[model samples]
Target chain A: MDREEIRVAVLRIEGTNCEEETATSFRNLGVEAEIVHLKQFYSDMIRFEDQRSIFDYHCIVFPGGFSAGDYVRAGAIFSARVKSVLRKDLEEFIKYNYPILGICNGFQILAELGALPGFDEDRPISDRPEMALAINDSGRFECRQTLLRVESRKCVFTKEIEKDKLQIPVAHAEGKVVFPRGREEEYLEKLKENEQLVFRYVDDKGNYSGYPWNPNGSFYNIAGICNVTHTVLGLMPHPERVTFDYRKNSFGDGYYIFKSVISYLEKI
Target chain B: MITFLFCEKLIVFMIADVHIELKEGVADPEGESTLKALRLLGYKRVKKVSSVRVFRIEIDTKSKEEAEKEIKEICERLLANPVIHRYRINWIG
Candidate 1:
């Protein structure tokens, strides 16, 4: 696979605001990236010529933003719509080891879709969600800069990240990742043992911290994770927003996310 | 309005009251915020606050069992997230 042959789809719906930047991030890396509407994949109203399939692209990105106005819980509406319509396709996508990236609300959507913490390769997408992004313990939206330490080499998205820690921005109300009630420790242990935990929130000193440092109070200071197969990934920070700095003429920490996935697709 | 006209009288269909809430031990930020507001308003004795989102759905179904199945699917697939939420459904017509 060549870099020119890699195709990325930045999945979007109403109220999803980060598709443009996300698509630009991929395109900046010299790959064919398109911001595609979810409806175009399954809506009957869509014209035949414009209709598309998940197989059309090598990677699908669920970008950030308040999808479906964050009603009935953030990302619930979007995830439900996706699961109801594209469940089998997405499951197959995961099983095939095609990269799937979700940022912020996209992270919530993937979690809601039961595509994260994919502990079983034979069953990548569970019938019920294995984890969720709940409202911040602060009881309000948290938007700030966060430091994340790469915790897993197993994830495809962070393998090329040159730094051990990345300074990225996080903005969301429901960013606290939680497992089923009372079983958080068990799942955290499993995630650790499997090397699926991709990014852990760190403080200024580069150590796992709490509160504003952790941003959403995510358990185990986790900021991002990948499935067991390392095909599907989700994180709370907006990697697209900080990919490059024009004046500095240098890549930001988030650049490695898009770069890593594209390299993986190209190499494979 | 058209349903009433079709029935000639407002004969009601089955109604479902679905309560969706975070599972026990999960934090409820909205409920906590509400509790904080109440405390500010001088409600001193409030020990705890819990929140539930209740939805009333009306469906035209022939049997209680059938309605139960459909509503359960609706709750599981949309109204509630099984990972962090547990839902209960009550039927009335």
Candidate 2:
């Protein structure tokens, strides 16, 4: 056993609900994965005193769950705490081009923190963040094994993933991608031109259809996106849930994403 | 003028401050309702409509400005969609 395997840190908040599964996924890939509780990382008595800096780990994962009870929207409250405490550390992490993955609720948190698409340098919080995870068009929680087509060749996390579509699972009610009022065209064009859009929903026949084709009704059927440097990734799919071969459905390709993450880390 | 309306006679109204552009491809259900209502009242050429909602919350604070500032965070994170909604507070003296 390689004792000095890649150090993977799974960030856990008070109401966070995906620590165990996230740990298991990384451990299976021969990585040192640990669930670090946010309270333990931060001081008990005051704010920002003992907060765990993102620099402590090689790869940081904001895993899925109902963080902060989704009280003030899905990930707003938790993301605000992270921003307030670890803002400088997060900026350095992004500057150094370290890998950061935000899955499901984490994606929403990342968007709220102005970490996705990477256009929020020194911008006011009142200014709307460029991307959003709106309520699903169907307006219901959907939990099913989903198929995602790898669309971008630039993302480091998806580098080893097959160029073709891969099977994964998506379980969420708010996953639709929305841009600021009049910036839809410009945003989509920039995302596509820069190869930031990493995945899209596609049918088994490889055709981009509707409803299930774009499970959450995201614009451009976008299922995942990465920052310009491809070091930061945010996706709606629950890749950790389907990392094992046994968990695969008859047509599941879930293992590919885990494999991709492992391969990317090894290269780095 | 201050008589209370009975159970079925209650009148409901909402005030909103939407921060959205009337661009194509965006959905405005509230605006659509207003347009339809105006049409029913025999008005014509109601080219466009846009709207928002406001809720006045009273908290214990001497400074109205400070109170508004504090509540804005709650509103942004909870009540209002920062993506398309803007809010201002009005005090009733």
DockQ of each: 0.70, 0.16
lDDT of 2 by residue, A175-258 (tens): 887787777889888888778899889888888877876778888888898887777889999888876665444323555666
Once fitted onto the true fold, the runs of candidate 1 whose alpha carbons sit more than 4 angstroms away are B1-12
User: Taking the true A–B contacts (Cα pairs closer than 8 Å), what share appears in each candidate?
Assistant: 0.73, 0.20
Error of 2 at A165 (Å): 0.7
**DockQ class, candidate 2:** incorrect
Quote the lDDT for A53 in model 1. Answer: 98
Q: Native contacts retained by model 1, as a fraction?
A: 0.73
RMSD of each candidate relative to the true structure = 2.6, 8.5
Query: What tens digits encode model 1's per-residue C-alpha lDDT throughout A165-189?
Result: 8989999999998888778889989
TM-score of the first chain alone, every candidate = 0.98, 0.89
